[model samples]
Target: MEAVDVIEVSREAIWVALKVGGPALVIALVIGLVISLFQALTQMQEMTLSFVPKILALFLALMGLAPFMLTVLSEFTVTLMDRIVALG
Candidate 1:
């Protein structure tokens, strides 16, 4: 493949990765921030307190977003395959 084609594929790969992972990451960050604030206010320093809720929140977010994520990934895959076919 040409350099331009390679760059375009790389860019699309990065975009797809961010699109797939961004929501869960954002949810986790928000949950962590809220838990940190609560801990600060209440002075509760139990490590598990922060860990468990974040895991649960992330899990729920992932589950809720699974279908959308799959659709995005499948579309990316199809487009990538089409590009490969065109190149060949």
Candidate 2:
């Protein structure tokens, strides 16, 4: 494949990765921020406090978003396969 083809595939892979990961990451970030605010307000500085909610939130988000994530990844995979076929 040409350099342009490789670059296109790489760019697509990165975009797909970001699309798939972005929601969970965003969820986690928001949860963590809220939790931090809670902790600050309550003056309850517990390490586990930060982790438990973030984990649970991320888990729930992943569960909710799994189908969308799967579809995105699969579509990217199909695109890659089509490119491979075209190349060969």
Candidate 3:
């Protein structure tokens, strides 16, 4: 493949990764922030307090978003394969 084709594929790959990961990441961020606030308010500074909520939130987020994520990943994979075939 040409350099531009490589770059295009790489960019698409990155975008697909970001799309797939974005929901869980965003959910974790929000959960972490809320947990931080709660810990601050309660003056309970336990480092381990962060993981459980974030993990649970991420799991739920992933479950909720799985279908959409799958669609995005599948579309990207198909598009990339098609591009590769066309280039070949």
TM-scores for all candidates? 0.97, 0.97, 0.91
Deviation in angstroms for 4 in model 3?
0.7
Candidate 1 weakest ten by summed lDDT: 79-88
Winning candidate number (TM-score): 2
Q: Count the backbone clashes (under 3 Å) in each candidate.
A: 0, 0, 0
lDDT of 2 by residue, 20-81 (tens): 99999999999999999999999999999999989999999999999999999999999999
Q: Which 10-residue span in candidate 3 carries the lowest summed lDDT?
A: 79-88
lDDT of 1 by residue, 1-88 (tens): 8999999999999999999999999999999999999999999999999999999999899999999999999999999999989987
Candidate 3 per-residue lDDT, tens place, 47-69, comes to: 88988889887888888899999
Task: Give the Å shift of residue 62 in candidate 2.
Answer: 0.5
Local distance difference test, per candidate?
A: 0.95, 0.96, 0.89
**Regions more than 4 Å wrong, model 3:** none
* Local lDDT at 51 for model 2: 98
